[model samples]
Target: MSSRYAFTKTVKELRSFLTRAYPIMKKNNPHVPILIREGTGALPRVYARYDLGQEQTCSLEGLSDKQIEETVTSLVKPTSL
Candidate 1:
């Protein structure tokens, strides 16, 4: 597959995943703002910007789907108090 296709696909999938996750995140971290942005790469180069200043670049590139899911979930979701 072309690099562009891969990147687009990755971001699209990530968007879908995040849409489902947003409600849960809002409930968990209502005071914090969460946003996901596409990063530079052919693969899933996605970043999650949390609150206002904290940013988390997904490091799940080249990993399995399950691993990526777990990584994204952990990255966007805040730790328990």
Candidate 2:
């Protein structure tokens, strides 16, 4: 995610959070693949793939790091009953 847009600060925060969280995410979710692309003209978004070709997404455009993390954790992390 590039931070050149209007929501630069939030996006940067997200990027930094992802940088630190990526490894932990991978370790916890070994079967999941996380792809991070940095470039211009790309909206901040997260995609989670599940069985049967199903996919979920969350827009991170102007969200703070905490919000981003919450959204991601809810999407990717398995919850206990």
**Which candidate wins on TM-score?**
2
**Cα error, candidate 2, residue 57 (Å):** 1.3
Q: Please write out the lDDT profile of model 1 over residues 1-81, one tens digit for every residue.
A: 686776666566666666776788789879976555555754555577656587667655545555667886777567632
lDDT of 2 by residue, 1-81 (tens): 454556677668888888888889899879766788876667878888877687888898788778888998888676432
Clashes of each: 0, 0
Instruction: Find the candidate with the highest lDDT and give its number.
Output: 2
The Cα local distance difference test for each model comes to 0.64, 0.78
The 10 consecutive residues of candidate 1 with the worst lDDT sum are 59-68
Q: Candidate 1 — which residues are off by over 4 angstroms? A: 38-57, 60-66, 75-81
User: Which segments of model 2 are wrong by more than 4 Å?
Assistant: 1-5, 77-81
lDDT over C-alpha atoms for residue 35 of model 2: 83
**Number of clashes found in candidate 1:** 0
